[model samples]
Target: MIKIISCILLVFASTYSFACKDPLYKDKYQITNFSGYSDVIVARIITSKHNDDEMYSPLMSFDAAVLEKIKGALTPNQVIHVSAKIEDPRAACPLYFKENSTYLLLLERQEGELQISRFSFPIESNNEHFSSYLSQVKSGINIH
Candidate 1:
């Protein structure tokens, strides 16, 4: 009887754990007005003429593909929101990039443009089990 009760309790705990999880990278980070998506290494952005500060207000580079999706719509010196995954808390210091940092990029298109928009960071999935999480988010978007 005790063994049977223990099994039932274990099943209940597992079900509850699964139910509480968030999908869609929603809990991870999100971006709005995200222009495009690109798969690139982190080193490129660090080496480029556009460092953290030059980008302005909130300074940081994002995935090339996401930037491309919205670049055409921005005007020179305009503020835009950028949403990105916060891999390192120290990367955007003084003004810490929000936790679970998915949002939007508000940027100013400048002359002699460094094309920082073209930069990207490779998505690292080895650390987290994100397959079901991403699928759930995708489904939520479709529903809307």
Candidate 2:
């Protein structure tokens, strides 16, 4: 147990210096056409699975239940596949979603697969911006 805890601490400690903190939006990844994303949805992650592959590197694929739809083809209560690239070996990034946590995601659809936008990051429910996002959506304003 001690060894396992030590390893966990080591992994996080090593990554923390280089990793992007959760729910942070750096302006470098900002999108100009923020209002024109093809698929934007507010969803709650239901399940999470980790995959490490050559094409995707280490990525997290989540099953999320739609709580609200901001645009595009999704409907409330629908489940969608959400995937995020985790470039730990190079960038020290890890999976961003937590099970049962809600997120506002901007997406791009590619050949029937829904992918999180390169310009955006999932806004986790606990993020400082989460409430502002919901408020903007409620008032029909630009989200971020």
Candidate 3:
């Protein structure tokens, strides 16, 4: 009887699913840590398009003009390309890059190219909150 009850409880527990909460907000220390972890730049999206090719389907790419190099060695006005996954309804954090919008991007360099993800530290270029974080980066604060 004890073994049968334990098996039934285990079966029910295995079938149960839990919903995950979205973690969209980054705290000050986390934002500051991104400056040290990835190449940080202020850039304007020159163009963006969804990849429709079957080989690269489900991806979106953006061509951006680097407005300023906050932490990285990127040259001002240089055109850089970045890519991310399309907005997934099942994803907790869906990142979308809009054309003509400016952003302060934390980019991860991969195989000689830059990429951004929903987990990447991306903030609007005009957001006032960024000033405080940028100041810390500029001051060479210890990110760890």
Candidate 4:
């Protein structure tokens, strides 16, 4: 029992220790052509799985359901896959989405698949910061 508890603690500590405390980019670009940049959606992360087998490096896979389509042709309730590297918070660009949480995501298309944009990070749907972006997306205002 003691060993199991210790192992759990260690794993928890390791994951938290990798959390990034700062945004990858501080500037927000006015999204002139929304579709040209990426597809914007309000989605809930259904599951997040960690995989380190692709490149022998840690990465997270997020399977999400599109709750609302702010822009682009994505159908609501559609599932999408997104991946992000597991690295120190300061060095990682792709924002990690928590399982079961809804987020305003700006997704770019890569190799025929939708992906987290190389621009800004994901914002929780209920977060104060999400409204501004949501409004911008709805209004067709350039801002990601």
| Residue pair clashes in candidate 2 | none
Instruction: Give candidate 4's whole-model lDDT.
Output: 0.67
Off by over 4 Å in 1: 1-59, 66-123
Q: Which runs in model 2 stand beyond 4 Å of their true positions?
A: 1-32, 52-57, 85-92, 135-144
| Alpha-carbon runs more than 4 Å astray in model 3 | 1-29, 34-38, 51-59, 85-91, 137-144
TM-score of candidate 1 to 2 decimals:
0.23
What digit string (tens of lDDT, one per residue) describes model 2 on residues 17-101?
6654443554233344555557778899899776655433345677999998877889999988866632334443455567899
Clash count list over all predictions? 22, 0, 0, 4
Q: Model 1, residue 135: what's the lDDT?
A: 37
Error of 3 at 30 (Å): 2.5
Per-prediction TM-score: 0.23, 0.63, 0.62, 0.62
> What TM-score should be assigned to candidate 3?
0.62
RMSD (CA, Å), each prediction = 14.1, 7.9, 6.8, 8.7
- By TM-score, the best candidate is 2
Model 1 C-alpha lDDT per residue in residues 52-104, reported as the tens digit of each score = 54323333433222322223444433333333332333332212232332323
Cα displacement (angstroms), candidate 1, residue 90, comes to 14
